[model samples]
Target: MSSKRERRWWTEEEDQILKAGVESQSKQIGEVNSLMSWNEIAAMLPRRTNKDCRKRWYKVRSDFIKGTWSREEDRKLQQAVQQHGLKWALVSRDVESRNADQCAKRWQHGLRPDLKHTPWQPEEDAKLLQAMDKHGNKWKKIATLDLPNRSSHDIRNRQVLKQLF
Candidate 1:
């Protein structure tokens, strides 16, 4: 059997060092330096592999945004969608603090003009339960195949509200 390495959380000091080292190596004119290997960066940190360093660098990127979308953000999303017509990465740049995935979800579920907002009926609830039983927490499958007009996020939220496993 192969040995698995136990995961270690990075300390603040380690993060600082990693950030400094990566920033120094990455900056060559305006783009990342292709000549600099992750192995070289990882060598600066104790017990961290090249893979770990690379993954961590991506995970802690300074530009990623999270949290609730605001009204202004919604307006920007709408404008972006109108301009770019579902080219989500381009749309994301126009909508501040949102990535392509966030923009897509917002448009598909929240901002879509044709999305229905009807209250869940008893028949729908029964169907949801039956679908959950059959699909085993695969919300997208349940949503698309079993419960039309419902998003995976909505299905998951409904399941939580009902305290269903």
Candidate 2:
């Protein structure tokens, strides 16, 4: 027997069912998300299999799951990653929502700020060299010297460029 069901888009009504299923299934704080069984939640949404119900439930729950991305969400994700590095758990916490996976995926694409690509002006290069001399190649500290639109990474890359050339 074949094992594939034709994929179709979910309706708003189905979304409502998924929300209700999540509500009925889960109760209280930090109970490990057993809420309702997959089978039970699937039964609540017509034509949705257990896997579908489970995946959809994630979309419905904002925590440890996600529904949609927003600009504000992208900003939060960027800020969190900046503050916490690739520590996804800590980043997600700072973002105030989303599972670690969602946070990771969003960060990999959205709000991954574009690196400076234009040729550095001579003045900027001089300032960078001066900053390096003052700060002793400490890129993070040099960046704090107010190189507009330049991150510590940019400061580091500028030094690398000098070595290469």
List the RMSD of every prediction in angstroms: 5.8, 13.1
My TM-score estimates for the predictions, one after another, are 0.59, 0.37
C-alpha lDDT (0 to 100) for residue 14 of candidate 1:
84
Candidate 2 root-mean-square deviation in Å = 13.1
Q: Give the range where candidate 2 is weakest over 10 consecutive residues by summed lDDT.
A: 27-36
Task: Give the CA lDDT, 0 to 100, for residue 111 in model 1.
Answer: 82
Model 2 misplacement above 4 A: 1-117
CA shift of 151, model 2, Å: 0.5
Q: Top model by lDDT, which number?
A: 1
Colliding residue pairs in candidate 1: none
**Residue 105 error, candidate 1, Å:** 3.5
Q: How does candidate 2 fare on TM-score? A: 0.37
Q: Residue-wise lDDT of candidate 1 within 1-165, one digit each (tens)? A: 759998799999889988877878868534333344679889999899987876676567667566688999999999999999998767877885776677888888788765557787888789999998899899989978987677777888888988953
